[model samples]
Target chain A: MSRPVSLPRWADLALLPVINVLVAFFVAGLVVLAIGEHPLEATRILLTGALGHGEGIGFTLYYTTNFIFSGLAVAVAFHAGLFNIGGEGQAMLGGIGAGVAALALGSLPGIVALPIAVLSAALFGAAWAAVPGWLQARRGSHVVITTIMFNFIASALLVYLLVDVFRPPTSMEPSSRIFGPGGKLPFIHELIPGLPKTPLNLSFVLALLAAALVYILIYRSRLGYAIRTVGANPTAARYGGISPERITIIAMAISGALAGLMATNEILGVQHRLINDFTGGYGFVGIAVALMGRGHPVGIILSALLFGVLYQGGTELAFDKPKITRDMIVVIQGLVILFAGALEFMFKPALARLIGGRG
Target chain B: MELIDTAIGVFASGLRLAIPLLCACLAGLYSERSGIVDIGLEGKMLAAAFGATVAALSTGSALAGLGVGIVVSVMLGLIHGFASISQRGNQIVSGMAINMLAVGLTALLGNAWFREGGRTPSLEGAARFQPIALPGAEALAGVPVIGPFYKSVVSGHPLPVYLALAAVPMTWFLLYRTRWGLRLRAVGENPAAVDTAGVSVSALRYSAVVMAGVLCGLGGTYLAVAQAAAFLPNMTAGKGFIALAALIFAKWRPVHALGACLLFGLLDAVAIRLQGVSLPGVGQVPVQAIQALPYVITVVLLAGFVGRAIPPKAVGIPYVKER
Candidate 1:
């Protein structure tokens, strides 16, 4: 017979996350020792650098925008049980398309240029991602294999475009010219003072709205029910007249377009001009975000904000402490993923008990 | 009259370029055949390359460098095995962790050691790898039609070329003719079956992954000590991923992997040569397009048109035993 969770409600799910955070601390300390640094000092500096100054807060919010978009993109695929590793390539090319549009159509009004650039990016990214989705749906090809392959092909193509076709004549940076002022996103600081560089442009709000839309689309819509059923059990879903084939295509395309939104936030909102590689592996890092969030939209946002802190704070730590490379951030990032992956072992019992159940 | 001679020279250069791919792909063949993914092959090669360069620079011995490369790889292999097999972690995650570790460690150590740049000191031609031209094959240069072709195509490659060529036969014999090979195959196909038969399933799988490390080590050392006589950061680039694609394209078979490596290598060699060689109507094709040709083809092939490619049945699935 099934049993209800017998533990006190407060001591169940809430306490478990605290313990998990402590474990993350221990793991991060181990890596610090391996790299020959004082973990406490590094952690202290990392925290201070992230929120210590006005600019630090801005950096945090800026990064949170990218994380939110990428996290949702990967989560959509994860909920569909498809591992879409091609996010980086998709987002990168998406940025390129956005950049080209922004640069070419500077004559348009600010409002029109921004939306056009973002939608163009979404369209381009969708077309690029459609190749892998088609492969999986049509030929019994594995997404893992095809996505990995597409990544290399996409990066190479981007590199070629940057060096040859799009190389700006005005600057030596391996990038196109700065998008005209008309294309610039209105910074939060520009509109309001003393906001700690929130960079609170229109796009961050859009991302929050997108998160809600994704939740509604995935959980409330009929399409959402179909996708969830397919993810839970494809065979059963198929037998019930739900088409796994069609859902795979739709879900992957949606995921890719959402990934393109990150380009909009990054290039159109914050950076204003696309560089050679604007992404610091945000697309790939989003996978970890999705996993840690349990594929929940709210959870994805929480995880995204946490990762945004790491990214922003880590960059600040790099400038302040020259001895430490940006790569240490990677070690910490990897450890976070390692623990996140192992969460089932730790959380299963606690979650079970939270509902008055016994294992 | 000299067009044929130029063509012959390019083909010779192409095979030399192909050697490292062959070595990495063959090593990939072993790991994948045993049902373990070797995405870390690039990192393994990179670490081995650094090991070889440091050894050669410090010890003045190529043989010592080769030995160091293999040992370093085995150690890295154990790291992969420790996390993936012992801790029961995900294989892809473990491989990715090692790759990240290799990237940071190689750069950190290289900077500390080099003190000038993130690159080791370059060597003289004396320290560099030399081609092992068979004497009579050199005489084939003077012969009529067949002689020039044989001399240009078959002769004048470095030791690793022959080693890479020989590894195909060695892999074939080890995979089909030996008991250890059978055990490895069993582990790849189903570790539980081997476990039921009273074998240590984890031990066998670990060995297979470790073997991949060894192969990656050799492939890497061949690049730095054998090819360039120096080391640079991220030098192996995405050849490791290319090797993985080749492994899949070959369907985890040794013979097919070798052929796939050669095919990709040839395309790579051709692309590099075709760079800056403009056609009359097209003006010029960017080197990037040519360089991207291999990966583009891999994507297209993965898009389901090139025959059929299926990975091993039990690949990337961790074997958890019944308690």
Candidate 2:
């Protein structure tokens, strides 16, 4: 007779974030009550707004598409043990670079322009992340601090360019005028006459394709092993003759490029132009998703969807429920991060015991 | 009289802005030198700024406000130290958590209490910090070269301006002079060696970080009650982070941090003066680019890839006491 075993350590690891999110939701319900809203009704409203209607689904799909890119960017860096907080800045700069390519070099055919703009965004993001990577790899400077500093610098630089250098001739707002029609991503409105609704365009398909590529690259490639080995233990990798410096820099650059790609999708497919706060805190949220997903590709997709629903649905719930503002959703997000981060404390030992008992 | 007075006013404003930066840099120096990463200086400032505003607004006294700010920041410092230095948590993560929590909680409390997003209502001039006009400046006002600059620069700055200037020297003395300073340097350089001695490593680290918070709090309160006379939402902006850069670029030295801050403050003053003044060829440089100058400079200085700066060895590593 064998003792019944609990989840293997690997499965238990995945459960930690799930448990944390549930606890966070419970705590957040109390907050809803304090805000004078019915917690049950608010939860229902949030779910319905994000996933129930066709329009809600459209919004969720659009958000999930972009979020997947951001999540993968952070996850890639994490796999190399480099905390890349500069994704926000890199994505912003990437978006602008892509926008410039679209606006200035839009005379080219659709297929060429699209590929060029996306590639340019990826390159811009890579270059941005490379600076900090070089600093960390060669100089022994801390990646976390340097990346944070770079993010601020990137944001300020982008703001400087957007306002003064990139202002189009016609628009008075901070944003540039619409990129030439050739540059815009073909919307579902034009692609299919009777789609579920709205401007949730082909970017969604592109995003899913990118995620699939990422999964294969991370799980099956020799390069992925090097990045993971470096992340797990750099000294061990060095002993094994893998240059940690090269892997670290390559990982960061790829991460930045991925984030940049996400930003481009939003600017090209949805908004049609760059504006102040255009990235909409997507970079920061990506960190949360990456952490929540434990840096797994499938987990990242799931977390991105969860975040998209929370974001799109939370806003709708806030608007319908007068006392709740979009800001309330931020509190919930913050709570999720807090609880998610506390995952090490929340699980592990108990799960270990459970596995031990089962064994 | 008019020209001299205007020059003095501009200099005074420059001093006022420069003081907070210097103070925050000093806070950075203390924490970094003691081998603890202190990115929560922004949160400390925000708490101090809010505390100072609330105290000043309630008591109608800027002094009390400054006091409240300092105390609250010290408490926040202890919390940061508890998490990062003692408990072996990730320093960047803890710092970020503190910052986010401060942002959320400050806004949450402010709205709930005052019906605004982290904004304390503006105060009366009398209730706020006012610059002290130095008496000796009048005697030297007529002298050439030194007189205009001196009168313009040093004569009309508020009390915190003087405190910030004094802090550089005070920091130098504290870092170099006492037994405590030696212990601090030891801990920063090699915590194991410091731990071998009689003192508690965690306690020393907590003290250094807490002291930093106090200084940063003073800086924050100076911003609200003294510089602008009100607490504005997210008013700390990136100043605290910039101060951290200045701390590093200055090689974590007190005197150097002061010099770096003054240079930045001077650039800011000159830019403001050049507001309407067009260059002979290039028309007025846009305000947005001018605003980005400090951040742009920060990146350039940090990329000093010439030879990378090394932080304290024990910095950001939590020390655990073993039996």
Candidate 3:
């Protein structure tokens, strides 16, 4: 089979994604117009609401932190030619791990309790992910289907644990008791007293560090080389003495570990307790983040920020224009995913031909 | 005799639940058998449910609603085909996109039109599918154990349930005993060979996908107009995914898919019944465990712990004709 001519570096890396984003926004604008709202005004309101003030910016950053963890989780797996759609389930299990750690170590200082929670989160996430990874690597079961099924199982498991096992006697709510004060991570506002109060916490810094580590691991390390090799051509990797199965398992484990950290941000940093559906589609949103970012650490960060804008800004848009609900934001996100992920190559061939003509 | 009666009642409900699942399972079967992996079955069902419900509300005709629902699902199927087949895009990504789009679009439109919080106005009597008594059901009910079984399990189901039952045999025949079915199966296994055989690979795939959409639409219509009176946000829940799992469990065979859907439906019925009941050896079986059974079983099956699952060789890979 013949392959289409590849686009130039500039078009592939920069121009195409920008064009896709524009198309997404254009479609979103049409929806807004259809609802009898001014598209330009809505865009202005969204930008201002998401980034205009310190509090909005802080909230944006806070959402971005969760996306980074889940995005990196997906990127790592994608590098091994694995689609780990189980981030939702992995993250849910991770919260239980963090919750257990916090409740057990609540009497200790935040410094002491925080590291334990983080450790448990990663451990739990990796373990949960490893099941499907092992199945895919050893038994040839498709990881995509397994991971998707795992998400539903994870939700049921979380509800069982929260309602049946972990809920405090006094509370009727389906959630565990609030963690002790020492287990709480300090919010950014506490560190910078002049800043506005937001859920933004030390986790943002942790996310940035994780992104850098992912960059080094994926682009700089020998393991990354092995992963890329397996993703690109497993037969060649097998010939080169690398076991594709082992790499698949290891890559998914790391991906799950990254996804697990999202629980730390929400449980330890924000919610202060284990709650149902606290992940709030963030894990699924990570798919869009990873796809739009092209699975690179830097790209993931940028796309994560873009989605943060959509989320925070969309909330404001819905509030300002009652006719347009928050679900419209999901529609816009879907459009972006469609253009950047599914229809990613739709425009490439045409663009290539145009570029060829220009030369 | 009393225990036997209760067993029949539970089995009846299981059959009722299996109707929607059978529709979706057949839908996924057609798509996958034609080399297109359709994870967006849930999305198509949701969109169809919303479309059907809204159309019924406006026109006051359940039949009209069913028609509109099929159109919407077919449109979604076309989008999936365009992205995965023509554009050579990632099939999974395309499916996810459709799912997300449906969730948002349905909610947005439902909220706007109904002003009832992302749900349609409930239909009364004739606006929805009412139970239809089979001919001589009353006469059959007086004939002992077999009578009650037929009365409870076969008679008085809405029209869609009967349609779903009829569809299984129709699907079986169409897939196994027809020339088009042969071409469809051949394309999924090796599109290049089909292309070499002078058949249009893309045309066959498109038709299979559209047929899948039509089946999903009927399933969605059943959910909204027959099982329930109105459309609610994400009313399909994970039934579409469960249907996909069923298709996989059945190894892409139409007849086996019917059995798989009924088995899942049975599991669901039992889970609902077992929620608070305490078993002899086990204390009240946790609701979560029963609810998680299907997924757990699917995973185990996929792991080759039970039966083997081998997808069509060319499934998920877009066909490209050699120059």
Candidate 4:
């Protein structure tokens, strides 16, 4: 299909990622074997638990919806050459935003409340990200370090808010009161009949729409060109009349907004109450998703879905095979990140030799 | 007078808490000064802490534990070097990978071995670094403020604290008062020039990273065997990042790093002290605000609202030879 056949586009785009994932699974299988579990049976269990039935698929999609937001968050920043590791913090802030919105507008109809909640989440997340972005763009501070610090700060802030300010007098838990009926998001089954009763909601469709918007913004817009240019080479981008600082801030804000959108899945779709640590490491997992996806929208969707499967499947595996605990999933995730990111080129030379020799 | 005594006690605790941070900051200083950004400092420290705890528990020897810690840390260091220096991969990604691997591996192994929900058994007596009193502590007990302060703050820490304190000056001497320091500095600032000067850039970076690992080992050992008796999951608890912040706040200087670590340590102590204290006018200050104080200050510092941090010029860049 390729004219000169240097390395087929399909191989570069699809084969390598699949191969890396396979390697990760292979190592994970060995780990399972070490723990006296059958690897082949484990795989079957993971897949079936994640995707075999309507209820399992619903849970998987619920998780996938969250990952899509975070993965896109990382990818947007990647396009501008900034590492937005603060997605965790930003998403937490977004949860707070959702809480505040529900509290303020709980008397309104669902149609009115949902949009306000979504807007609030995105705005709150963007504000959180903007500080680091401004520091990087205007003050020459490193975004990565500032964002990491912000994650801790965000956690602290959330704990204070939930415990001191928002905690219901009747409740002992460090979580806000449940949302009123008007503020609650409709489940997917309610929106469309005959589906399983699960946490899956309108947020999944929102995620898909957001993906489409991100694709258009990134691949077909002027700002996208400027972001890509700055990421590729700042000096050249500057010479070409794009302001690097402006692009950096804009890109980071967009990343943060995307990350903030993740709150709708947990706060609106599932829990309907703001709780501490609700993010549950999804922000960090997003980094792996972004890297595995090669920072592309399509790739990100696929990777996010893959991680969602892993999450649901891993839970099942742990429950079924108590010896293969949930921590084993983290080990497999780490292996995937290690191979896909740090050792990305380990197989490239061999592949090149094989292709070149064959041709 | 009572308030002053409380303050002194807090200072002592702060000093104790500062030891691990001091080691980590020095480790980071060496690695970054050699132009290799080592975000994996947290990962290395955690791995070392686990190794130290397990080894100390098994062998009944703190020294063996320290050796195990250092070896594990150095192995992580070598992995970072291979990824960043050899393969020319992204330093941040590699560092993050190390952190993830360390966290996942430690929990998995700990759960498999002890089954106490991913924590090592608490060490006792010989298995841990016990606090040692200086020779004159008893004699000076009768003296006033200075005596108690010295005895509590400076004299009775485990050996690792003293070693960590001593490491500051050693690091200073190595970075400023030696030929090796100059070459290391040159490599970070301009690897091309170092290469032109016939020194191998990769070798310098690898050495720096390995040195960082050793320092991280001491820090981790202090955490597990001295600071606490067992290795808890996420026991490092972002101290590695705090150390990085301290390094930046110190502008990558050894002596300044000591001050930075102490300041963060003091912040932590104050946060603990302020947790439940009620004030007359306002009310109790929330612990979360105090807990977040250091990071807020760091953000302000990074924003250049205070001082600027200019990293090494060649940092995060692979030194590629011209063909």
Candidate 5:
């Protein structure tokens, strides 16, 4: 066997991730085939369903809005070398936060109520994540375990609040009352008249603005430099007078804040009320997005779009192909995580050999 | 007499619930002790439960179901081993992938094959693990506290319950009184030292991982075949993580793992009984608060409130050979 070699930077950044995604798709196709479905036909249907018409595109982009928030959340934590699996819990708490604010201030003007809801979402999410961060920083507890545990705790807490506290007297369902007119986010179609009516809302613009800000925060700022330094080497960072503990907590807070924004798209924009499990596994999907995007903002946007396509397409596929369920996308997501995140270096040595790099 | 019977019933139910946790916790103990962190235990158990249910439904043999469950779980464990051990990948990421994969595959396949919304047909008669009554259990039921305790708690459980009970002592003996156990512990603590002594670190870790798979398979199979008659989607329901918390609470010791799992099981049983029941001065205890207790206690314990739960020294670090 030949010794492993490094690829050129551009190829490392672009070509490798594409290969991983293609391999993931290939395995997904095989799974479809195993279920006695025609893979090519399924792919055609999926692609067409996700991108065929104006409404499909609108729905896809709406889903993309949520993914961008969550992917950015995971990426920010990755920059600080913290695996924040608590994104699911944080996002759930964020929904609760947004719901609280919207319910309380719904009679107020839209301009005043919406921002408060968004801010509350961020604060609740940050607080939810900060405890685990503080535990890891101060008490030597592993954040991964703590975050995983927090996800379950958050689920139970959500059920309790929804069933016992938030449910309306007339309703049998475990959900809060719908938000007032001021609390509702305007659909993008309302703003731009030519577009189809979909859940795509002002939150889409917020997601883009968030992506741009995250780009600046991770690359162009001094704190970004400190975060990256601490992630790369804690000992050297400490020698340079930067506190690793503080950076860990800060990065986690920022990550949690980004994750919290997902609630804006789901709760305020679409649901218009606090529903049980409104996040709908997008937080876990964010791990796949962050890994596939290689923790870059631009890459995250692109990968988020891809997942959105898969999700919208999978829903359509379920309608067309009775045997193929929506859960097929989860298999694809797992494969992407496997190939892109865990076995990321599996194809590296072979790729280097082909690209003619010197060891 | 009525109160005693209710207490006996609750204790018996607690013991039954503890069986799955006991198996998974012991499984985690082996893997973590050998320096591999397995967050995928939940996924493996879910897959095993699915496999066991499907196989038992078809073959009408509970033993065959157990066999298939173990095979399926072991295959997943090997995949984890290949990624973390041979490929030198991130163990946590690999475990997460395994978990997601199991969840998706089980649901998708179960739906495709059975068409019952991601569930197999219920097991019955020969397809399920029937409870076995001990000799003279009925005859001794007329006696006092000792007879009721012995008959209800000790007897009338399925074969797997006894097997699970026996596993605790077996694991203790294997881990403490054996040379292979010493080498396995050494590999987890210091792989370089084990490698310098000419033992294959990867080989020992793989064995430990396989052992974990076998144990999880038993727990999962028992869940479907004895405790429940059908395989439900997402049936493991975070018990894997609870077992993991119990493992930490036990501080990775075999005997302590048994105690911790039973305690958790008792908490679960009590929570179920207390639901909607108004106590003196407490007015209707919230079931959700009781349900969340295990996770909250774990977080507090992990934060060093109940002393430090130190993991294996080299745990979660992939060993790389220096060139």
Candidate 6:
């Protein structure tokens, strides 16, 4: 057998991701062509829709906020070698928690009510994740399978609460009443005079703050060291006096809390009320974001922004070409996951041979 | 008499519902037994369901639909094999990719082609699989107790139902009795040992994955052509995951998988029946609670509140030979 060729850090981190993304888009283009649409025209529409005007940019950034929270959630868990697919459920629970707090404290001032709702969202998400983490830690269950199961359970719980508990008698829809003014986060347009009115809001700032905090927690903290050590090699971590089980639970908790913060953008900022399936598959999208970003905070933000562009652009494309619905973005997302994640090393050997030459 | 009628109805519905779960569980069983963790079973089934529906609509033949469904599913299985076996990639991530791709492609193509909001038209006549009735079903219906049971629970079903029932024993025999099955199971348990024995680990894994694809295809065809008669967007819902839970609950054994699938199917049937109806002790049971029972049970079992589920030894790890 031949020895494996190694590439420099720049090629490994920067070059490979760009190549993979280009390949994904190339395949997505083929899909567009297969459906009797012009891929180039579609791409033009997407780019212009996402970046052409202030409103488009605002929508893109607004979507980017939710992705950032979910992406950071996946990255935190990834650092601990846990694949936390339950972000969907955790985010749903976060919405429920935020809804509960806002509805209960609706009469209070925004200074008091809003912060309580945000904290409630995190606490609820953490608690939902802690159960699966505890199960995996104590009983030796695989976190992946357990988290997947929890996603279903969480959705069921969400539906039950919406139908039986939250829905007002006067309303027929399975959703809560519109939240009070105190509960709603101020829109970004309100703060900045000239910006077009979009769902973009203060949660975008919160998402950035969360990203910075995650960077510090993962790279600068002692707990982060233990988490990384356990992830890399559990037997070695155990030998070095770190409890892998404890780290697993803690990492999952933090991951779930980050996922929960997405509600600050979706529920508190945009919808201002609890609704079903509002997470809109963004939690699953986070997996792609984290994988494409290579589990780094900086990479996650960039990838999240990319997905935001796809989402905002896809919506615009749908208006121009009914044949190309938002599902096109999902296809692109899948291709990205395939090339950038599962087949990540497919280009490595060739690239190494090209760069380093014969050994 | 009325009580007996209700019992027969529930049992019949339960059996019908169990076919898809049983087929998918068996599909997972084959792949996992050969060291490939196939979380993409859901994706494969969903794609196959769409493929089957489209082919049936075009050809007006249910068998043609089944053929196309199997081909589509096997293609996806090959992709998974390429990623996990050849490229030595993360099996879970590969499976995830397959799932998302299937979800997106099915909806996108279905919408573009049919223009019914991502749904295919309802299948009818020759396009749908008609239930087969046993020779003595009518005669048996006249007798007491066993008559209705035999007629409702044992007699009439589409071809896929019987195929699913037979797959269990076939899988068991293949896994435990046949030479190829032994090699496949050995590769899953310890691929290096199989390689040392001069048998090809990748070949065995690829075959197992192909077999999984065929079975999932049958399951998906059952959903669109036999069970539902049309392809609905996200129609598989979480049945694939439910089947996965059943696989875990069964401890990866074929006979146990049948039992587990039946148990879950029965729960589903009961949940459907109990909706909007209040019982004496339980009151009006929330549908979601019943729907969540299978997942909760799987989690508890995984936590070892029930028996332990030890998977195949080398499952999820890529095989790489040492120099």
Candidate with top lDDT is 6
Q: Residues A1-359, candidate 1, lDDT per residue (tens digit)?
A: 22333445565445554455567658767766665667788778888877777887777777888878888888888777787877888898788888889998867888888778878888777777777877788876777667777777778788788777777776667777778876777887877766755665767877888899999989999988888888888999899999988888888888888887778777887777777677667887777677667677898898888877877777776676554556565655555555554332345355555555543
Greater-lDDT candidate between 1 and 3: 3
**TM-score (C-alpha, index-matched) for candidate 3:** 0.98
Model 1 Cα shift for residue B36 (angstroms)? 2.4
> Global lDDT for candidate 4?
0.89
lDDT of 1: 0.75
DockQ of each: 0.33, 0.24, 0.79, 0.54, 0.72, 0.80
Could you give candidate 2's per-residue lDDT for residues A254-280 as a string of tens digits?
998898887667887877777667777
The sequence of per-residue lDDT tens digits that candidate 5 reaches over residues A37-73 is 9999999999999999999999999999999999999
CA lDDT of every candidate = 0.75, 0.77, 0.90, 0.89, 0.91, 0.93
Badly placed stretches (over 4 Å) of model 4 are A1-8, B280-283
Q: Where in model 5 is the C-alpha error above 4 Å?
A: A1-4, A357-359
Which is the winner by TM-score between candidate 1 and candidate 3?
Answer: 3
lDDT of 5 by residue, B1-323 (tens): 88888899889999999999999999999999999999999989999999999999999999999999999999989988988988888888898898899889999999999998888889999899999999989999889977898898999999889988999999999898998899888988999999999999999999999999999999999999888988998899888989999999999999999999998898899889998889899788888888888888888889999877899998999988666
Instruction: Score every model by TM-score.
Output: 0.87, 0.89, 0.98, 0.96, 0.98, 0.98
Candidate number of the best DockQ = 6
Q: How many angstroms is residue A109 displaced in model 1 relative to the true structure, after the best TM-score fit?
A: 1.3
CAPRI quality level assigned to candidate 6 from its DockQ score: high
B317: Cα error in model 1, Å: 2.6
Model 6 chain A poorest 10 in a row by lDDT = A1-10
How far in Å is the alpha carbon of B322 misplaced in model 2?
6.2
The residue pairs that clash in candidate 3, if any, are none
